[model samples]
Target: MKIDMSNLKFGAVEKPEKIGNEYFAVVPYFFTLKCNVSSMNDDMKKKIGAAVIQKYGKNNVQYLAAEGAYLINARMRACAISPDRKTWKFVILEKEYKSQLVKVLPKKILDKI
Candidate 1:
């Protein structure tokens, strides 16, 4: 499946940084973006969640309320988290690399995938 990055809307996105195999040997392509915001509030989460649902379809997006994250298509993973009060890190791992990393994922996350 091809993910059209342009279709997904976001707020205050900074230039994305390409992630390499040093982080995870299995996934050949990975990248992360920083979404700068004033605070990590419910509204921000709601907006990002909405954008994800809009881009991937509600049926393919699963919201993990406990983790405050969204898992897409059971193969592709997308989640935004606040590392600090002013920055939200948005990480997206392409689905094409999932098969190689399946065995390394925790059981909890693997079950959802």
Candidate 2:
């Protein structure tokens, strides 16, 4: 699975700086990611998460714990399917403490925006 986090909001921690003797400085920071999900398959998702864990270290990816584990399909765009297909919930991130809920907009809407 190709997981692209190109549009997701996220936080990041800075590397620790070593000082002389036994002192060190550590800084924690947060940043939003333009994340994307790709090549979504169940097993592939697991591998992608594992890869993220490896790259960002376990602590960094811990935020995902609240959201649960899911796979990212890089090639797949979040588009609405026919009624016969299962409909999924849609959400838009808000800068405020709370998120804004919205129904899935039609593909045409995306094109306009």
Candidate 3:
């Protein structure tokens, strides 16, 4: 998804944090994408789930407790895609910490994987 940076409305973040290189802005839960994760096809869900599991993990309980994500919730940070995998950047919520740039596998590619 293409996130409009200018239109983003942050929730309770007092200030943005610089984790390493990228810059992230905190936002409220209200701004999260409204879509049914289960509504997606098995392959698509599997792809996204795999990406999530790879980045996060397959253990739902462990993922939730360790990653600060709730069970059954797919948390997504606004990211900018680039041809070079090293350029992918995302903004984390809460502290608005900018995570390290990593490859963001597209949903289509994830299905094929």
Candidate 4:
């Protein structure tokens, strides 16, 4: 999904905080995905996983379906937008953040990744 950025809307956010090299801002994920995670095939999943790792760096990226969500729900301050992973969303705390995180990245970026 080539996100227009402008079409996307963000929910309320807490005050921003600086963690490591990035500033963190907490916001809610409003189930805005072109497709659902449960239906994606392995190849597709791998493709998305790799693209995410590339943009966010393997060490800095994560996928929180259920368990992962629980783990990050308390302390994570950084999140990748559903599609390209080019945009990073920061949240102050985990309890309030939410997203389906399933957006199609640009074809050019996908080829490079």
**Full-model lDDT, candidate 1:** 0.45
| lDDT for each residue of candidate 1 in 1-113, tens digit (9 for 90 to 100) | 12222233333432333232112112122222223332457888688778767766787676567655556653234433343324654345445556754644433333333
Query: Which stretches of model 3 miss by more than 4 angstroms?
Result: 1-35, 61-113
lDDT of 2 by residue, 1-113 (tens): 22335444323422322222221222222333322334355566567678766645565553243344433322211222233223422222222313222233332333322
Candidate 1, residue 16: lDDT: 32
Rate residue 6 of model 4 by lDDT.
Answer: 21
Worst 10 residues of 4 by lDDT: 67-76
Q: Which 10 consecutive residues of model 3 have the lowest summed lDDT?
A: 93-102
TM-score for each of the candidates = 0.32, 0.28, 0.26, 0.27
Better of 3 and 4 by lDDT: 4
lDDT of 4 at 93: 28
> What is the C-alpha local distance difference test score of each model?
0.45, 0.35, 0.37, 0.38
What is the alpha-carbon RMSD of candidate 1 to the true structure? Answer: 16.1
Give candidate 1 misplaced runs (Cα > 4 Å): 1-39, 74-113
Task: Encode model 3's per-residue lDDT on 1-113: one tens digit a residue.
Answer: 11111223434632343334443333333222222344455566556556656653465312222332323333434433333434544433222232222233333322322
- Each candidate's number of clashing pairs is 0, 18, 0, 7
**Cα deviation in Å at residue 100, candidate 2?**
45
Q: State how far residue 102 of model 1 sits from its true place (Å).
A: 36
Q: Which stretches of candidate 2 lie over 4 Å from their true place?
A: 1-30, 34-39, 62-113
Candidate 4, residues 1-113, lDDT tens digits: the string is: 22111224456654544443444344544322222234566677567767656544565445656522111111123333232334664322232222222223222222222
Give the lowest summed-lDDT range of ten residues in model 2.
18-27
